[model samples]
Target: MTTDRTNWAGSFSYDARRVHAPRSEDELREIVAASTRVRALGSRHSFSQVANTDGDLVSLADLPRTVSVDAAGSTVTVAAGMRYGEVCRELHEHGFAMHNLGSLPHISMAGAVATATHGSGDGNASLASAVSALEMVTADGELVTVDRDADAERFGGMVVALGALGIVVRMTLDVVPTFEVRQDVYEGLALDTFEKNADEIFAGAYSVSLFTDFVAPTMTAWLKSRVDDVDPAGPDPDWMGARRAASAHHPVPGMSAESCTGQLGVPGPWYDRLPHFRLDFTPSNGAELQSEYLVPRAAAADALRALHGIGEHIAPVLQICELRTVAADEQWLSPAYRQDVVAFHFTWVRDAAAVMPVLKLMEQQLAPYYARPHWGKLFTHEPGHLRSLFPRLSDFRALRHELDPRGTFGNAFVDQHIG
Candidate 1:
């Protein structure tokens, strides 16, 4: 009984013969143990085929949505299927919050961590870096719990394993006391100004995002600053000649800003301001394709310059491009592993045929910079090329082999890119 299922962007339909949503952990373990091949499906936010399997696709959506905060330990254990939005609110109510959040709050916690999904912050690590522990149902139906403190050796590899090891049941993430954030959008920042003072511009706020079409003379800068971190008497609207937007503005040129988070430097909770989009509204351009390349922060200027040189070719298929910074982390497969990075993200018009050529060109231009593609986004990198990009690829493959000897979690995507 094949069911027609596609990801959030209505791209890459699943190849699984059946989809299951077990009501309990026992049922989930039984399903996993019985299947010859299996993959876990989250909120279907990924753009790639990483979650597709031929035999069965299991969704944790039906499992109990648990969110327990351990104040003493400064951590929160959330059900794998729970959305960040749901958990963040609960955490805030309990006087706690996750360190950061990706743009979309509706994405599943486990899926986000598994892909090393992240937000923009020079000081903030990928979402996976906050995982203190995680519980997974392995291929043989055994429940395994690994914590960073107890199993540091293997835990690093498991955080961003690309769903090849097992189905993540729950994750215990590090949390901090609730904090307030003020968001402001600066428009008309010239390309030269951005390139010249990139460091100061990014460090201007706790989390900063620059949105552009590559061909544009000026880009919009979305700056999210911690309220307490800023001095109240300091001069405001000092963004290197960029004018502050009087009203909220969407990243996409013509799209309505109604779905975006509050701006104009109004202080709000971390959950509300950290992510650009509001949880109640659709995130980004609903009809879009995304690709991101993470490069060493040192090569950021050269990478941006290279893109600027080919802006004409990119502007045709591009909806928008975002420049963000992420701190280094120890997650084995994380793009930001061991080095602070500048992420060049593209939100393209949803046309694979038209986007492929542009992606190839971008990849070629960025090859010298050693760019690593986002695990869940579209990319043209081959398995061999990817192996060269990630130093721990062999180790991750070994760990996968150890945990799933029969290859129960193996899928076409994993075989092609990970194996």
Candidate 2:
């Protein structure tokens, strides 16, 4: 093991005695067949230890890179290990694009799909919802395929199965014709103005994200509009009482906008404007911890009000807070399962001792909404209570056993919470 073998955030040190990098699927199967315990490792962007294991860890980065698009079918089959940014750029070059992307595109296909990672939009679903098929190595080191279009209850359970089903090796995602986007930033919007026009604000663009320090006198808005969907033109000098930004602005107040994607309504490829930060810059340099909760869409105003009451407690440690939306999806483990949701994401200073208490307080205030926490982020929710919120957890538990009967892939996180 190497001392440098820490997660991207450097906040979590893995327990794996070794990290194996195999160049071929055949070799990967051999390693899995030989090891008594194993887990697949991706880009390592996960904030929590959800993907960590005590025995052996497998990194697919060395595997052959693949990005094959079947233009006729409007789908792209990519190597699961490929980062979203790499894959999206390739797709765009081929005149295709994924419907949406997370706030950052550096995440791996398998890791992002497994965690139900999402982007902002009232019509867009979580990234996993775009996956039409999955190819994985089962517990017995044999390959198995699941097709969502052929449609099975099992497929819904497997899409966001938390890595307990199998080690995803390849994924086929639905794609669309290439498009351009322009991002417009609005500054100094009153909190009440946002609360009153929440739905209109999100609907104003293809994707919209509101950023605030929770205690700031005013908040910033990033509206990413599809060039074709909206007028390729620009918005007025003011939008719903918010002033148009004359220059670039970062999501976190006062930070260099150089690390962020272009703003001020400059149109660019879908891959460029869809995400907040540019792939060239590592977001926050792994110096921040994150937590997010997805609450029912109807409770948006209420949820915002609840958090506003705690701004004094939240302001000290908060780097920034983002409010985005995701349409309902059918993935069994997805936080938005069966209900549209508004996600409140918090980027906290990396001081766990100080942050943990505030997380508990936030959860308490959000308890009325029965908010579901993001599976891959740091959350203070009790394991049992957290699992209970997902109605299909029992079905997922059964699916886990069906795919990994001997529990070869069951880590502490899986066993303790996913049971």
Candidate 3:
């Protein structure tokens, strides 16, 4: 057994080889072309072994950090390896920002987009939805470009390709002018709040996040909105409907789930409204396991109800259950593929032995909805079930062959899904 160790899934984990940080796209091309097997490493935020490889591991850390600003069209072309927070800060400087962000900012843009990472909004789509175009290095070391109108099928598959087709080098994203946001936290609101006004509440802002322990009588809603109509004059208490301090302090038992302390308390920079970008606050060095499933938007209420039934059991080891939304898109591998989706994310202390059964239980509970799992996250479904989850799976397979006919990009994870 190899003893070489490095960080993976938020902890120092064992791997066979030392990770390689390639300084340029040319270097990346050379490495992939020469290596018998390879996997592109992102910020290592993913909870699965999706990026794991026994052979060469390529890090895009040396990749260029460039965010091109286009004031006229309001778009930014960013390096695929750019951290989410870095993108926000850079975009903010250019007087622009993205529509929403996942809960933490430490993840890489390509990684998040590849997994269809998202925040809440009935009208908005997943992060991949922001891509106007992107560039990737295919299996044969050939660089290719894809966009909505050009090579739509390849673009759709690569949008959330889970790093199976190729290594994304950069992406052009549509942006909007910088705007401030008011994060109104409503704690202990009736569960009925969601059941009754889900639509209106979702429409109330550009994005919305609901955090629930399942046992609590009320949920916490963080309503994020554009600065356009924000009423700063209202009774804006620092903590509106705040939850108990103990919960925040000890949310996750041992893992650093990353609190919004630097983030949650204020209506600071509107441009950094995403949950995942705040870096200084995340928990330090414990392992974590995650399972996220997407249900139809209309079934969100029902999903919550089912979760409530097992709230207590899940809460002990559960770090958090986050509710987000995504508009349907054509991406074949996207969790939100062809469906207005409601995503429920569950974070558990890294105990695969114990967590597996609970995740299976969740699958059974959510079985009726044709739920699709995230590409770079954990799941138990077989290849057939995975194929059934995506409407464009066949098309994605076709593109996979066209791009990587020799299956040079194939790994255990990639092979299982698109083989």
Total backbone collisions for each predicted model:
0, 0, 12
Over 1-419, each residue of candidate 2 has an lDDT whose tens digit, in order, gives 12347787788788998889888999989888888789988888888778999988988888989999999999999999889998988899999999999988888889999999999999999999999999999877899888986757578898897788878999999999999999999999888888888889888788989998888667788999888877545777799889999999887788888978888899999889998879888665478889999999989989989988888899999999999999999999999999999999999998989998999999999999989999889888666776668999888888888778888888988888887
lDDT of 1 at 372: 97
In order of appearance, the predictions have TM-scores of 0.97, 0.97, 0.89
Task: Judge candidate 1 against the unseen true structure and give its global Cα lDDT, from 0 to 1.
Answer: 0.89
Q: Which residue pairs in candidate 2 have backbone atoms (N, alpha carbon, C) closer than 3 angstroms, thus clashing?
A: none
- Candidate 1 vs 3: which has more TM-score: 1
TM-score of 2: 0.97
User: For candidate 3, lDDT tens digit of each residue in 250-367?
Assistant: 2332434345532343466754555633566554554778889998988888887887777666777777777878898767778788889888888777888777778777777788
Determine the backbone clash count of candidate 3. Answer: 12
lDDT score of residue 35 within candidate 2:
82
lDDT, residue 2, model 2: 23
Runs in model 2 lying further than 4 Å from the true structure: 1-4, 282-284
lDDT of each: 0.89, 0.88, 0.72
Candidate 3 has a TM-score of 0.89
